[model samples]
Target: MTFPIRTPDDLHIEKRDLKFGRDDAPPRWWHSNDPGRTAFFNALSSTFPVGEKFFMTAVRHYRDGTAEPLRSQIDDFLYQESMHSREHVVFNRQAQDAGFDIASAEDRARRTIAWAKRRSPIQQLAGTCALEHFTATLAHDALANPEHLGGASNEARRMWQWHAIEEIEHKAVAFDTYLHATRTMTPFRRWLKRSVVMILTSLRFHYVIFRNTADLLRQDGRNDWATWKGLLAWLYGRKGLMRAMGLSIFTYIKPGFHPWEIDDRSLLKDALRLLEAGKPKEMAA
Candidate 1:
């Protein structure tokens, strides 16, 4: 239960170059046709292009002189994250074209990443690992529960499902890089550092998303009490994403945790096949 645990031996992360069609006329709730859900995901999409750059840079900071499987994984991790940023940029533009206030939300996200960039490189990588854990948890929830994505337009569903699959595929890259780079530190020090980073990152992460949600609501001219009420219900209700991810989010703090410890690759079988099946139709644009 100490440092330097093995990264998954099974990951084969190949970057997929794909695109989702933007509708000529899109609904406000592009995802699941639900305002709250759509706002939440819109917030995520607006953030990804900037956030993924931070993830890649933070991990790449440690790439020099890295050897063996992790070296190749790091290269592919960079490739995958770069692609995620590109795809999400296109998706976010579609959100903006749909009349959402994506530019304002992305301004907030940019400021957040700017703050992280001012921190030390180690801190940057630690924060990246923390956020990766959060994404992986949400990815698992989306893949495992059909309701999260249920009723969404096919293009929207397919883009997110593709993103989720890749998130799970490379969930541990930053953490593995962190562990290798920090192997000399005491276990307690390592744990304490990451634990603090995760706590701070999680708080900031939620604040940004919720703030962006409110921004979207106001832009839609639905900032009334009932709209806020609906957002709360969507977040905390029986079928809510927050309720489902409650326990999974805390798994990162376990002493000897590894991304593949849970073996959810079983979930990837269909996701990968579907992604492979759709690659040909990914438009260039």
Candidate 2:
């Protein structure tokens, strides 16, 4: 609703050291027992470890000169991201044990991160900002609309919902860091660089997710047209997660876009409540 809403002063982006799927392995088709849906989410999970590291690297490059509130937010962002990567590492292992080839998916993510590391710091931050927007929007959708993951097992659902909550909490850290890093650039140039990078980032992001999903599905022996059709429909059909997020995703390219302008904290609060409720009893205490 507004052009800017700083990360809530009272909202601490906590480093939740929670674990998921440590004791019980979710079924191979963890999301509604559907191979397409399962592979799609598994593909996304495969990228988190390396991808979050790159995000931290890019944001951390600009940390020194950042102002107070944002500096504190950056520290919290790094902590939350580290935890995300760690949990996803465990979740990816579960997918691997479920008979999918996670090594290749992780390798794909590593290669992308390696390539991104070669770019200038500001460019890399711009890329991080782009990807953060994508993640934040998807996270908001997943949390705001429960049916997106309604049928998933408790552990898997809680894992994803927890990730979504923190994502919404610190969604703007990368974008804010990018803006501060490029403060010297002309306004037009700043906009141009971020907008262009968002385009490039979207292309690469989609390619990796879809390609990895296809690769995983192939391992399940269902990479044919029929399987792809189901996957496509799951993502792009009516009531689809991606379809639901289309407009929110496009908001990133607006001239003066800020992640908080949409104000989805209500979703964050609800999801956080559910995640806390689902925690192990000892942890909850």
Residue 220 shift from truth in candidate 1, angstroms: 1.3
lDDT of 1 at 161: 88
**Top TM-score model:** 2
- The residue-by-residue lDDT of candidate 1 on 28-111, one tens digit each, is 687766677788888888899999999999999999846668888899889988888988888888887787768789999999
Per-residue CA lDDT of candidate 2, range 138-220, in tens? 88878877888998998999999988889889998998888777777887999999999888888898889988998989888
Q: For candidate 2, list the clashing residue pairs, or say none.
A: none
Residue 183 of model 2 has an lDDT of: 76
Candidate 1 lDDT (Cα, whole model)?
0.81
- Over 4 Å off, model 2: 1-5, 280-285
